[model samples]
Target: MRVLSRVGCHLCEEALPVVDRVCAERGESYDVADIDADPVLVARYSDLVPVVFVDGVEFATWRVDPAALDAALRRPR
Candidate 1:
């Protein structure tokens, strides 16, 4: 999983712990990317800073549901 985020974004900061806790419980790993650090990301995710992706596919945005995230992690890839 990965989180597309930017500095000083409160929503992004809020989403991090949710993602981290869920991934940690599932023994999965995730990374965070600063959208403003890359031009393409900045353009694509300019208004969507707290985006979450699982297996390279978008999973959630703005807010993350821990139950739903756990369900996704339980699925067979």
Candidate 2:
């Protein structure tokens, strides 16, 4: 999984820990990228910081629900 986020974004701040805790609990690895680091990413996700992707597919945005994330992680992929 990956989190697309930006500095100074509270929603991004809020979402990261939830991702971290849930992923950690499940032993699932995840990464975070700043949208502004790449122009295309910035263009594509400027308004969608804190976006979460599971297997390169969008899983959630803005807020991450722990139960939902856990359930998704548990699914066979």
- In order, candidate lDDTs are 0.93, 0.94
lDDT of 1 by residue, 1-77 (tens): 89999999999989999999999999999999999889999989889879999888999989999999999999899
Q: Compared to the true structure, candidate 2 yields what TM-score?
A: 0.97
Which parts of model 1 have CA positions greater than 4 angstroms off?
none
The numbered model that scores best in lDDT is: 2
The RMSD of every model to the true structure, in order and in angstroms, is 0.6, 0.6
Model 2 Cα lDDT, one tens digit per residue, 47-74? 9888999988999989999999999999
Give the distance in Å from residue 74's predicted Cα in candidate 1 to where it truly belongs.
0.8
| Model 2 / residue 25 / CA error / Å | 0.5
Question: Ten residues in a row with the worst lDDT in model 1?
Answer: 41-50
Q: After aligning candidate 1 to the native by TM-score, how far in Å is the CA of 3 from where it should be?
A: 0.5
